[model samples]
Target: MSIETSEPTGDTRSRAAIKNALGEQARALGFQTMRITRPDTIQKAGDRLLTFLADGRHGTMEWMEANADRRRDPRQLWSEARSVVMLAMSYAPETDPMEALARPLEGIVSAYAKRADYHDVMKVKLKQLATDLERETGDPVKVFVDTAPLMEKPLAQAAGIGWQGKHTNLVSRDDGSWLFLGAILTATELDPDPPERDHCGRCSRCLDACPTKAFPAPYQLDARRCIAYLTIEHKGHIAEEFRAPIGNRIFGCDDCLAVCPWNKFARSAHETRLHVRAELDNPPLADLLPLDDSAFRARFRGTPVKRTGRDRFVRNCLIAAGNSADRALLPFVAPLLSDPSALVRAMAVWAFRRLADPDAIGTARAEHYGCEQDEAVKKEWDAGTTT
Candidate 1:
């Protein structure tokens, strides 16, 4: 998997100076840390990805299976890519992110989604770095954030950014688990940084804290049972088994990342673009459930939560409402029983049953069961009535 690269025909001192300048420029661009690694450093990551896919750990994210080879080795993605420059941007929360869990009537969004999308933020900074590196080395370069088919964690670890924690997220001693990784792949041969080593020993706090027990083992994740995946990626009716465990997390889950002990040394993000928006911190489920498509887009216009679209996002809100035991949300959840999207309608049924009494559930089912066309929605009514 290693590619043979010829030594650069430049003054060694000049090259060292360029490397040091690049690090300084990256810091100036708001990246917390920057390091370099060869493309061949992550050759072994492909096999682990294959095993993860075979075990169905990726769930409905079929793109991972489609782009398997390119994700494993950066060389396959770009033939001339001899070196990878990895960058980490800190998005650690200023306040305790887990506090939102206590407010059952509020919807909890993952810490990263509380501000503008990181992909947009990171890509702009990465392109600036790539432009500078290309001008200095006179070599072609390509930049990628999370949007590309790259194993960012492995490459970041290879570049000494951080070790992949037991939760399979890049955990930095400096940035904790709140880092957003980006990469610059270039044809130029640059010195690689030393790789980071695992700091997690016998501690299984992350694994034990998962609401749905998504982790089968340390350093592995099953996306199907993950609340983050269920709310953000899974586009259909969430299995009844995971609904209660999903709690009030409307967009993504952060229980595992928030519990990591290494965060004791982590500081709040200095990047202004990553600062948490006050409105999104702990949005009321009642406020979110009433949003139409246009209103939803307007409310979360620049944030990551908008990408989930109104249907999926409201569906998640309904799940949170069901668990909230807040009867006040019943009026908001009632009209959605006839929502155009079957996904929303089914969850509305579930939420209605939870908030209403047995007599109210019977009365509502009697009125709507015959009019429901989607078999799944009807099944929800059936399940609600029986239970």
Candidate 2:
């Protein structure tokens, strides 16, 4: 349903008319809401970043600090850009994500990344919207999803799409917290909407629900303690303190987002492609521990899980295997002690300690500790045997 474009009129009524046209286009493009946000001083964006940084919550995401000034103000990214069009697409899933946690032997994927890569899904739509805006206004449009330094959550909140919940994610009344944010910055000067008020009130459900205590306080997250960060972003040895608490979440953690009471209001997504695949939704920890690069790529192609690569992802699976208490999975994790990925080898040793018996451990040590190149894996193996 393409809206017909009219010749540009430099009148207040003309701007108002074009805004409605843009809004209509956004709706037709499957966005929940679209609002023009004035590109002005980003006091709020700066405040959010400053607070998160001062608390040492960003963890290993050094990229967030690299473009601090540009992240705060969108105009720094493009001097001529006047108004930002904030768009949201709902990717809500049907089943309760909490159910996966109870099945300790199965891996739990975060709600968002369980399906097709959102960048692939949303970036195409954003580019189409950009093209449409250019056709209608004869002006340039710059689109951004999660890829840019721009603080999308703050921009979405300011654009009246939603307020940042205690989890520090934009949550809309219509879409709950299951919406993916995208932005299209344009030179067209559309009128801005009033900023949305904080509707979070006394609700601390998101904070209370976190498995790893990622949230230090309302609206602040300590990513160092976040399971999502540990599994996906942090490249080294999984921290000892957070391992067991991570449970079987091998890819990313969604405990906080999953527990939001507002999700009751969320309708299931119409996008069939966003539906969770059976294999990825609850893959067995034993099955995931041994996926070589080719098998991982073949299985996870077009899915967000591929980004972590086979080694990092399998390392996470090893941790989940350690915590599974299945004991049946011990033999499966045993061979990974000689895994080429040092991180995987280290985690395999931990899993052997947790899941393998004295006989199994002795056998693994006798057969492969000689071949173990990683000092860390050897240390864990020696400690596991001695203890």
Candidate 3:
């Protein structure tokens, strides 16, 4: 429905009353915090995004460049959007995420992906909140999760829900770094909450903790060097330089987020659906390597990992297997050397090279290298033989 721009008459509800009621509804809908801000509040976000894109820091994400205008300011997305209601939901892990990194044999899925996909979870709640606001205010509304063009972190900060930290992710003093963000944009006029200030002082714990040094400076990220980007976004072979530092993280990297000192105040996720599943917490790389397309889909059904598809997911597993240095996984990694996808075959060769002794490497090289038509896989074989 189109928005009604005309001012409400004497029968209209008070804006303060609506805001209070919406806050209560938000909490009941599983959101931990909610705040409202003007659509034009994030003026600087566009410039920063342009600079990041101009420097080629966004990597292969061309969509960011395409949607730059709408992402910079919410008003550009919807001219009638007067107020933006930002919400945050916590997904803090019960156990330490860093501990999983030490066990190289197991793939470390990011804490957020260990459970149900937050996009699906948060989208449902956002729709419900938007519906409630429309029922009360008779205003047109639009809701967005992570996939939308809107820059959520800047909007969240503008609404006083959180501040953007040096790690370049939103950080709440109450919920810390583990919070998932969502937004509701409405034509209805509402008082904007006080904006959050930068709480990160001289502490560079997030920057110092990066395995690949993806951050060029505080509050900026270079996506090409980021493990999360390599594993989740970038397709094809992960560069040799990043493979070792990627460790066993198969999905996304949480090194910077995990190291933030502000997370001390964080509480475990209140939503039962967001809790981690036991099987996915620290799955063995060996187990993941055997999953065919069907098995991979069955394993990650309803999770974000499924979006990466079987080839890329197993390719990540192969990288983990290579870094694992576990000889037992050699048997598991061997069969994939003949897999159909060049991406999978290439990664398998990499894993085999890492785990196999000279004799074993020679045997596999002799068997597969002769028939390997893909130039990339051939390079992997040559590299393996030389190494």
List per-candidate RMSD values in Å.
3.7, 1.9, 3.0
lDDT of 1 at 169: 88
Instruction: Please provide, for model 3 over 201-295, each residue's C-alpha lDDT reduced to its tens digit, 9 standing for 90 to 100.
Output: 99999999999999999999999999999999988788888988999999998888898988999999989889888778889887899999999
- Show pairs that collide, candidate 1: none
lDDT of 1 by residue, 139-228 (tens): 999999988799999999999999998999888998889999999999988878999999999989999999999999999999999999
- Each model's lDDT: 0.89, 0.83, 0.89
Clashes of 2: 0
Q: Provide the global lDDT of candidate 2 against the true structure.
A: 0.83
TM-score of each: 0.96, 0.95, 0.96
Kindly list the per-residue Cα lDDT of model 2 for residues 116-138, writing each as its tens digit: 88888888888988887777777
In terms of lDDT, model 1 sits at: 0.89
Off by over 4 Å in 1: 1-9, 385-387
